[model samples]
Target: MSESVAPVSRRGFLAGATALGAPAPAVPAVAQPRAGIVILIDRNDPHVMGHAISYSGNLSRYFTGKGQAVPPIEVVANGLGIDVFRADKSPLKEPLATLRQMIPTVVFSMCASSKSIAESRENLTIQLIDGARLVPFGIGRMVELQRKGWAYVHG
Candidate 1:
């Protein structure tokens, strides 16, 4: 007995070869434990600022609650939100301090542009609370953090 074998067409063979030679789809990198978080706060309302602070604290708790280490968190304040960082003007001075102590990795950032404008308009020097740093621009800082694979939160 003789057995007959079917021949593959040139088109079918080329298609199969192309499919096999195609590169696999790229995958997104998983977030590492070292990844950070950036929070944007641009409102002037005291309630809003309070909420932002609370939100950050809650995030820290979330990590700890899961028995995981908390990542670095940055709260960037701009526009009217800069007022929340003013040492003498902020109603949250004590709370801010407590929050910082509770979460050492949490940082509060003030926008230099907003500070300059606020000082010029209000005719009062702006003072930052302890642990708060100044960034050239709030939005820019957030963008940089995001590029570095940091999570983002707006409050």
Candidate 2:
């Protein structure tokens, strides 16, 4: 009598192996930089700044989840974005408050020329932190930051 042997397929073998509770293969961990991202906000509208701020905050959280460190982010406002700096004219109360909670995590920068215009031409009382560095131009500052190896993100 000839003995019959069942043909074993690769899938069957794998199934049997899995049934034996074989450990899963280890995956190589990917290395990511712990550097922060620089977000440049140069909107001329309060609503736009609010949206930009929200975008920055969301991006920061996303980078943190991907095992990457987000570098210091600065939201430089000039032209019309300075409206958010004003107490009365500011329309982004909620967004600004959320940004304030991030505090030192995110930096705020305003254009020197815009502030000058606000004071001299508009006569508006705008408040900004001392940490907010004033630059001669906002777009130029963004380019400078990019040239300095800082990742430039615009909202």
lDDT of 1 by residue, 85-127 (tens): 9887887888888899899878899999999999999898888
Off by over 4 Å in 1: 1-33
Model 2: per-residue Cα lDDT over 16-54, one tens digit each: 777899964455796654444566555666556766778
lDDT of each: 0.87, 0.69
In model 1, what are the clashing residue pairs, if there are any? none
Q: How does residue 112 of candidate 2 score in lDDT? A: 80
**Where does candidate 2 have its weakest 10-residue lDDT segment?**
32-41
Clashes of 1: 0
**What is every candidate's alpha-carbon RMSD to the true fold?**
9.4, 13.8
lDDT of 2 at 107: 70
